[model samples]
Target: MSRKRGKSGRRAAPRRSQASTRRSPVGANAAPAGRAANRSRILLMIVGAAVLLTGAVAYRVFAGTSPATSSSATLLASTAGQAQGETVDGISCQTSEQVVYHIHAELMVFVAGESRVIPEGIGIVGCFYWLHSHTRDGIIHIESPVDRIYSLGNYFDIWKQPLSTTQVGPATGAVNAYVNGVRFSGDPRSIPLTPHAIIQLNVSSEVPAHTFTFPPGL
Candidate 1:
């Protein structure tokens, strides 16, 4: 009877060992699953970072507010005060901006394939000119007391900058002009500043014209 009890005890010990061996695979499999989950999370983080970077670049290009544009704005604004309260090309500066015949036009200038900013306060100092700019996004506000034909040359005269086939602002090269996405054959200075006109000037290198959507009530 004693021998039989000892043999039963040895048999129970082997059963416990078998149960422990079966649980070992569960722990081994769980380690691999945990590692896979961590890798997936890392991959998702990398992809998300790439997407955010791409979005920022697209917004900068579309809004035309890159670093270069800001620098150009500052440079142009520095000299804009020189023609304050002066009559330029029959356009007079008034104590306040007139909007009786209010209109807006957009001008885009590219030099060597780079876009330049048309600064704000083009005809403003202590007063406002009929042809003036209120922003640095290349918008020219035509706020006149009387309705009449206004030309791009008139605006440039107010800006006190040179505009010709061989010159634009300070850039000198063969000038190419576009009006409302159409190639303009006349002298670039003669391009009319019609209501909602989209004018583009490229110096040296030619660039395809781009259209701008005016803000509401512009």
Candidate 2:
């Protein structure tokens, strides 16, 4: 009983100090309202920055285009008719044992039942033949005959890079076909073309079909 009585009065000392307490470091002297608000805003800014960075990294990983894998043009439809109108009248394809040919001479005439031509001296690789006097109208041609497997070489001054295929067979029947490092925009449709294949006259031109030449001995 005597110890209990002494403990109560000692605790009473804290009550007296509370009755006359002074300002303290974490109380009245604590950070101002403006300073506290600034701290909160800085924390929010840091969180937002982290979220934005994460989104950017995810986009790069999933949506980026690789030079070798990405194609500049779209996949053309199955046949050349899309170039003209509603029928096979506008486009045509001719195949030789060794080469595939497309002639864009005149689509209107083709629609009217006409054909385009192929030129000669075209089998040699790196040969440049100007089909039209107009450069824009000229046919950009390329060919490759394999003395060995997997040896492809192209020299088109138009494109600064050599981005095409040099395969023997048709390109797995896929659109946007490539052969011998040559890129062609057509339906996977091609000639009955094969290795060392030769044709008498095959001159392909994008000029109007009536005007395209089918020069002899292609």
Candidate 3:
């Protein structure tokens, strides 16, 4: 009877050891499963971010608007049109932009109390024009080979738009011009494109002239 009991006890010990071995595999597989789930969650997050970015780009493209100066501001298109390589008001379009006399000026236009975006690539169409805009922030870039005076009229010509006391682009009203925070008495088009000059035009309503701080290395 003692021998039989001892044998039964050994058999029971092996059964417990086998059970522990089986449980060890389950514990090891649980960690791998958790790591796999974490990886899947990370992948899902990355996909969600990509979708959001794509949606934003699509919205901007289809809406025909951008994050510009004002929410209600309409972004004006390049009026360079068919006059890309042609000279307008003595402003030349060359193969490359000249920096011999490079300066920047700011132009602000408001019609019915809403701002207007002077878009980039105004004087760019397969070439670079002397008087051009590189951004929609209203900075007009005067890059020419000669250091001479250029007027707002020349830029309007390049833009293929009209500017007068009664007209600014397609909007027509009693237009007011300001330069460097001072009221301009003469033709708004005659306002010279001076270095860091702040030129503002208002139609139908007048607002106080504002100054602009040019960016460094502008």
Candidate 4:
């Protein structure tokens, strides 16, 4: 068929279809859209990886099972010296000299109107010091070649636990140390480990224990 012509006798150009118009621009712009989508996917992957790593770290910390922590605990325990149902540090408490002096002391703890049992192993570790405890009965045995002043804090240090004016283990609050049936008005840590000394560390109890009877032969 003959093409239509304008009045100047030139043929008119073919008009573009709606589908072609839509597709041409979309195709031209496709590269940027694809690049944006890829960037978004990479960002999402990075975020997910970071979240997973953080959660793993948090779990390890919460569980107290981190390698560093475990290794440190093992090192400390080994250093503290534990063997044959006994724990002691590198320091040697045993001496070839005869026991020139011997003394006994008692320890008692009260928490919230309840008697807390002191464990048997105070001063047994890191070289049972010149002073030691054999039983939970709170009898601290000061057996040494020479008599020397020792403090309740010294014993606790060998035991490796927190004992201060404000706290004892899980118990928190004011603490009082009584010696020989009298309330000691100084730092509980400073209570002297005198012979036949009756030391009572009371937590949250203002009134000290009246008496701590020593066992026979203590």
Candidate 5:
């Protein structure tokens, strides 16, 4: 219903219907392009979520199988082998008839004629065993309620030192183990923990006479 005036004329014929407005090529393609962008954003979010989930699972697995737990298990397996009779190798003691039983034992290490001091404050972390060291004087304090033959192996395990028939810590050579001045021919780990027991290890050298005197009230 639109009209235009003409020069010197009353009115012109009604204008033909305005041609339908044409859509731009760009605008015609915009709707599908917008949809595609939304889909891409959703895909990225999904991928990110999956990656985070995988990382959490991996962390849990590594934490469960940590080195400390593995090493302790291996040492326990060795101790099980040593416990066939009443004592573990040469290490045997009656569990306390009372609530607790405690024993004192000393350890000395010799490498190439030099004394290696056993450090203090060993066996104080994570899961503690019945056998543990209380001081830097190399005094092993065996505190237990259940009777088990705790061996030098258990102490060494708690100490986290490399000890075997062929190796002792950083000193790699034939290891000679002695208990109470007597030489042991079996595996060094089999040495027993007895009250007032004096344990010594000679790595790549002659076993020296233990000069370490027990402290008073040991």
Candidate 6:
């Protein structure tokens, strides 16, 4: 094909377009490098703050705290000594609600159908609870959260407590339960336990049960 020239009548082929620009390696890597730098800076800040806090706590423990105060603090904060069955049994026996001790040397609790986030709202209303009436081995045993709400007969509907005092209190030991902090049943520690029931061998406060034992940490 004949080419046309714009000025002075000189024939010329059309000018080729310049090659499309390519990104330089340095430029291409800049974004990721910037992101990595930002991430590193954040990590360093977190680690530094953690180190500082840990150092401060260590100083308080070793230097600022006096011996007597330290002992009291340790006992209150659970650092001085393990409770009855904590270390020798290889588990934490002490816990608030939502945690429990098990007979198999482990931590335990029950939740219905989920990991216990708002477990009471689930379908556990009439579920059968099978905890022993007496401790089988240790100091304290646990009953079902289900039973705590269900077993009170018509009174439960009127009283509105998850567990009655008599139900949760110890059947036979020093760790008898109290309803609203009052001894609910006969103090298990008293000399005259129900006939055919009290045995010195089973007078422990926390008892590890066997049947229906949930696996440790469950």
Given candidate 4, what's the lDDT at residue 60? Answer: 61
CA lDDT of each prediction against the hidden true structure: 0.80, 0.27, 0.81, 0.63, 0.63, 0.29
Residue 170 C-alpha lDDT in model 5: 61
**2-100 per-residue lDDT for model 1 (tens digits):** 333355565333346666657677777998999999999999999999999999987666566322244443342344435777687788998988878
Clashes of each: 0, 19, 0, 4, 2, 11
In terms of lDDT, the best-performing candidate is 3
lDDT of 6 at 107: 11
lDDT of 2 by residue, 40-121 (tens): 9999999999999998996454323211112232221122211121112111222322233322221010111112121222
lDDT of 5 by residue, 40-98 (tens): 99999999999999999975564343222222221211222222223322333333222
Candidate 2 or 4, higher TM-score?
4
Candidate 3 yields a Cα-based lDDT of 0.81
lDDT for 141 (candidate 1): 93
TM per prediction: 0.67, 0.23, 0.67, 0.53, 0.52, 0.23
lDDT winner between 3 and 4, please give it. 3
lDDT by residue (115-197, candidate 4, tens digit) is 65555555554355566667545577777666576677766666556678987655777988778877789778788888788
**Candidate 5: worst 10 consecutive residues by lDDT?**
68-77
Clashing pairs in 1: none
TM-score attained by model 1: 0.67
Runs in model 2 deviating more than 4 A are 1-20, 24-37, 66-218
> Between prediction 2 and prediction 5, which has the larger lDDT?
5
lDDT of 6: 0.29
Residue lDDT tens for model 6, 1-218:
76777698988766555544666789899999999999999999999999999988875654321222222221111111212222211212223322222221111111111110111111112221121112112112332222232122221112121223233111222333222223335532232211122121112243322122222342
Looking at model 6, which ten-residue stretch has the lowest summed lDDT?
Answer: 113-122
